[model samples]
Structures are given as C-alpha cells and as structure tokens.
Target: MPEKPPAIESFKESTKSPESELSPEVLEKVMNKVQDINEAGVAYSFVSGGPYSAGSIFEQDNLQKTKLVRILKEGLLGTPEKFYLEGVPPTKEQWAKEAQVSLRKGGRSNVYFNVTGMAHEEETPNTQSGETWISKSAGSSKKNALAFIFDLSKFTYDDDTNKMSRKYYETYYKRSTRKFTTAYGFNLSHRVPPRFFNGILLKLQDNYQYDQLAAEIGILSEQVYKEKGNLLLPIYDVYGNLYWPKKMSYEEVKKFVEERDKNKE
Candidate 1:
C-alpha cells in the first residue's frame, strides 16, 4: 500500500476560500493568459559582492526564489502600495514592529519555532543590509527563527489565481531559500529576470536530486493553483521520520522533510 498525504493546518487563522480543483495540466490559451502574468526575473538584488546566498537543503542552490520571481512577475506588477521601505536591511525590532503588522507576524518567536536554524554558517548569514533578510527572533535561535527582509511594497493581490499559486511555490521555496527580500512590505517578493531564477531551481534539482518526480510536478502544481483552488501531490512510497512546526520537536522537522527522499523500497 502507499502512504497517505500529510494533512497540514495553516498557521494563520483565516480560512482560504474554497477552490475548484484543476487537472494535471492546463489548456494552451490559459497558459498564454498567465504567460505574460509577471515581471521577468529573479527577486535578488546584490549586497556587498553579489547575490547573497544561503545554504540550501531542499535545493542545491536557491532555485525556489527564481520560481517566486516568475509568480510575482504576473501578480505584484502595478499593484497599489502595500507600504514603502527605506533600505536593504530593514530596521530592527523596535522600528520594524512600528512599521507594519505583518512584518513582525511570522518572524522568529522561540528557539523551537525557528525553521531556518538547520543551515551551516555558510548556508545562512546575517551580516549587513540591502540584500536579503536574516533576522532571527528575540533570543536563542531554536524557536524564534526564520530569516526575512523588512520591506512592504513587494506584496500584491490578484483576481487571477497566480497569487495563490505563487504563494504555494514560495512556500516550498522558503523551506530552502530562507532568503526573503524586503522592499514593498507584504512578504517575500521582488522583480528580476528568468535566467537567474531558472538557474537557482535547476541548481537545486541538480544538487540534492530527489528520486521522486515532484520537482517537475512542482512547477505545474504552482501553475494549477494559479488557475484553480485545489492542489494534488504525488505521494511517493517513502516513509522517513516526522516533523511538525510547532507540534513536533526539532528532531521531528528534520525527519519530516527527510521522509520525502528517504524511502525507496
């Protein structure tokens, strides 16, 4: 027999609207409609040397960010101002909290809460500003974790399903990139190019290289949510360990992510 899909509840309280399910693929015209949907580029801006990098687990490099740029290219373009940011490195706690409500909402809360602490020093860093955010929560890096930039203008909404789809891709991407850009303010978003974005995802799939076909499906699942509300996943017959954001211990998260690639027999 096969393992069942993992059921997850969203951290936030609000209910996402119900959506009609989509098939494994979309028609040609629908593809064309969303083809020119977003700005063409990666969301990265340079820091001191070039694109600041964080080590990745889900990907070899930061390919998830590239997928993000593509999603937002269509959605965040020409939207109203969510908020305005001042610089590359957003101001610390006191001011960031004062700026916007959502900015500090998802930040590191407790040592156990932190999901970004798994990286080696090379994969994660918080040196300066202007590139991406590596802001850890108040104290001990265990619970209060996750690195993100402090900008507001980068967020946008849409009548089309791109926002939801992009968000889904970004959700997977954040697990690896952890590299959040701050500018407009809502959350992770930016405007760059396709090559860098493509390069990142390609590098990730090339690097760790999972055996399942989820990577190919990931691109399409991302697009499907753009059209319909529901998503389907290819549950490979692999059982590793288990992890929960708040429910499980650190050991659990490690096991949970590992499960996707661990079982093969």
Candidate 2:
C-alpha cells in the first residue's frame, strides 16, 4: 500500500485561516481550479563573473548588486518613505552576502531564490551555468513575490466550495505582466497572506538551486490539503533532508546522503 496523505495540522498554524478546517471534498474542488497553473521560466543569480555553475556551492566576498536585486527589494519591501516592510521578508542583502562565501569545491550550481520578477525579453536565450544572464530591466516587466501574493488575493473563493472562476485567472495574468512596467503596491486584504510567501522566500534564500523544491512543496502542500485536507510531509521531509528541493526521490536521497557521509568520513 502507498503512504497515507499527511495531516494538515502541521501547516494549519502557518495558513492561519478558519477555512483551513476544510473537508477533503471541498479541498478537492479548490485543487481542480489550480492544478494546471505553472510558471514559464527559471530563477537565477549571477556571481562575480556570471551565473553560478550547478553543484558548486561557494560564497562570494560581496553582494552581486545587480539590477534584479535592487528591483526586488524595492518592489516587495517598498520605499522607506512610502511604507515599511512588514512580516518576515526575505533578507536578500544578507542572503547575497552569505551566498558569496565559499561553501564547497566548485562543479556546477544554481541559486535557491532567483530574481523573481523579470520580463521574458530581459532574459537571454541558450544560457548555461556560469554564463551571465543580461538584465535590461532598467524599466521592464517583472513579477516579485509580492505580485504573486497580490494575484492570489484578487480571486475570492467560495466559502463552501473553495474555488474560483477562470475569468479571475485571466485578470490575474493581465495584472501580473506588462512591457517596461513594475508592480509596486497593492493593498492585500485576505486569502493568502504575505507571511506564507515570505516563508518560502526566506527558505529559498538559504538553499542553492531549490526553486523547484519550493514550487513543488507549495503545489503538493495545496494539492494534499485539498485532497486530504492536510499536508503529506514536511517541506524538508521527516529527516530534515531536502530531497524534493534538489529534485530527487527518497531512495536517491538515501544514496546521496550515504555517499556524502562516506566522503566526509
């Protein structure tokens, strides 16, 4: 027999909604609405010369200080004069500083949390590890964590069914994308809160090349919640080993950890 679905109690405190006490049948209704949604591109960061290679974890002596960094900080955190950043936002500055340090010997790698909101035109084609991704977003369209939060807020869910309409998704895309534009502030009311996204962003800040891990956890968490009205596993898994974030499986994770430990020994 397969593993049973995980319980929702683990994630309920984080979700912080009365709606979280949803029945499996109701949660399934919500899953049907969101199952097909996906993002189009990968997120990344540039080191001293260019993009970091895969599996080569290292620390830099200084922040990369690219345009994407500035834009993300400003877009999500807001200007000091306008509004102070509330809740647990990702410490991009600190994250950059730490990522610049030498972690392990080099091979090939990717960043955990990439510059989220970048226009399709801003990215270069045929890019590879260690090569620079040109960011011409002097004034370009981009989606930050804030934009996603705002998008989630727009669509109201039915109290009983817990689902939204296709028309809402169409509007969300319209608001999230545009040429030479940036999303600044949209007063968030309810639905998914900022802390939810902040948790993911902060987690992303710590790892190297785990965007899929975050994405998968978010999707799976929601799917499981809807199907069983609970979480199936901790995002980091029971052993505190991050297999999915590295895009691996349980057996593969066991082998990888054993090999790593054997090498260390």
Candidate 3:
C-alpha cells in the first residue's frame, strides 16, 4: 500500500511579507557573493559509495570560512554596514555555535536562508542530500513568496551520462519530507558541471570555472522565476509526495513509475 500524505501541521506555511527588502546596491553585492562562491566551487569528499556509487555520500566542512557558511553570512545576513551597525559580525566561534543550533532546529532562527546537509546512513553505500532554500522570510517581494529550493549534486569527470543517477534520485526523493515543503516554491536542481571537477576531485578553484558555474546558476534562476518558465519538475509535499505537474498525488506517481518499469521489462 502507498504511504499517506503528511499532516498539514508538519509543514507550516512560510512567513508572509518580506523580512527586509534588498536595495539595488545590496542586491548587487549579494549576487556578487553568490557568484564568487559559485566560481570558487565547494570542496567535498565522497564517502561510502566511492566515485561511481549512486548511493555515495558527499561530505564537506561547514566551518565559518567554508563556502556554504561564508555564502550564508555575507549574502543572506546582509551587508557589512548592516552587520557592523547592528552589532559585531558573528565570529568563527559564533558561527560554529550557530551552525549547531541551526542543525538542531532544522533551519536558522532569524534568517530564512537555510542550508541543510542530510546524510541518511553511516555505513557503506550511503547517500547524502544537500539543499539550500531562500524562503519568503528572506524578504523578496517577488510574486513567488518562496524564492527557490536548490538541490545540489556533484558531477564527476568519468561519468559521461550527464544525468543524475536513478538510485541517488530515489534516495533524495524518499528522504525529503516534513520540513521540505513550501507553497508555490520553485525547485531548482543543480549538478556541478564536470569542468569544475576534472582531474582534481576534491576542490574546484579556477576563476573561469567559478564564473561559468555561477552564470549557469544565474541563468537557471532567471529561466524558472524571472521569465516564469516551466521546467516540468515535480514539486513534493510534506510527505515526499508529488504535488504538481499533473496527478497531484504520490500514489499516481508511484503507479506511473511502476507502469513505465513494467513496460521496459
């Protein structure tokens, strides 16, 4: 039997009204920070499944200076003036403490930009899911209250398919529940292009590569929200059920998948 949809209480409606608007000047600064990190590319390690293991986990440090943390602090936390004027910027020690807090709470308390790295298992053949969301609470007046949900994936050099592995997709989809849903939120899946990971599997640091990656993300962002284009990706509900792109139910999706698999057999 198929699983039931999650209760409404599990996934609360996102906060209405922008927390704070970003001026043109501040918006530019924030984009620049995002571009910088995209260009730098994050450092990560493959655990459990090795390079080709669809179930492998990608692990990275969430330190104050790391790409993830830095992006959150500088980009979403507001400009230097805002931080300085309000109070001293959070120190490395402070960020470390907040990271723990954020992890425990499942999201940041004050800011709406949440970065989550979820690893399901400890043993071999594990899968890791990394998600970044700029919720309505981030303060954008855009029509879609929720800015976007970024699903991060790594691309390997030897993998010529240029597609996410089926196993990984299933794992990610199954694991996303309860805290994952948002009303009218756009879902954007990003696979770091192979160029950034060629030769060196650990870190990507070429200025040109970073620019390209950042541009790709920017283009995708525009395509989905700016132009209001449709990518035909399914939106998931709190129960990890398909909530959009027809059927509007997880059982329908399951039946469809089963039928397709049967046809192939």
Per-model lDDT: 0.24, 0.27, 0.26
- The ten-residue window of minimal lDDT in model 3 covers 123-132
Better of 1 and 3 by lDDT: 3
Say which prediction, candidate 1 or candidate 2, comes out ahead on lDDT: 2
Query: lDDT winner among the candidates?
Result: 2
Judged by whole-model lDDT over C-alpha atoms, candidate 2 comes out at 0.27
**Lowest summed lDDT window (length 10), candidate 2:** 138-147
Q: Model 2 segments beyond 4 Å from truth?
A: 1-38, 41-120, 123-177, 180-188, 193-265
Better of 2 and 3 by TM-score: 2
What TM-score does each of the candidates earn? 0.20, 0.25, 0.23
Predicted model with the maximum TM-score:
2
- What TM-score number comes out for model 1? 0.20
Question: Weakest 10 consecutive residues, lDDT, candidate 1?
Answer: 236-245
- Stretches > 4 Å off in candidate 3: 1-154, 157-230
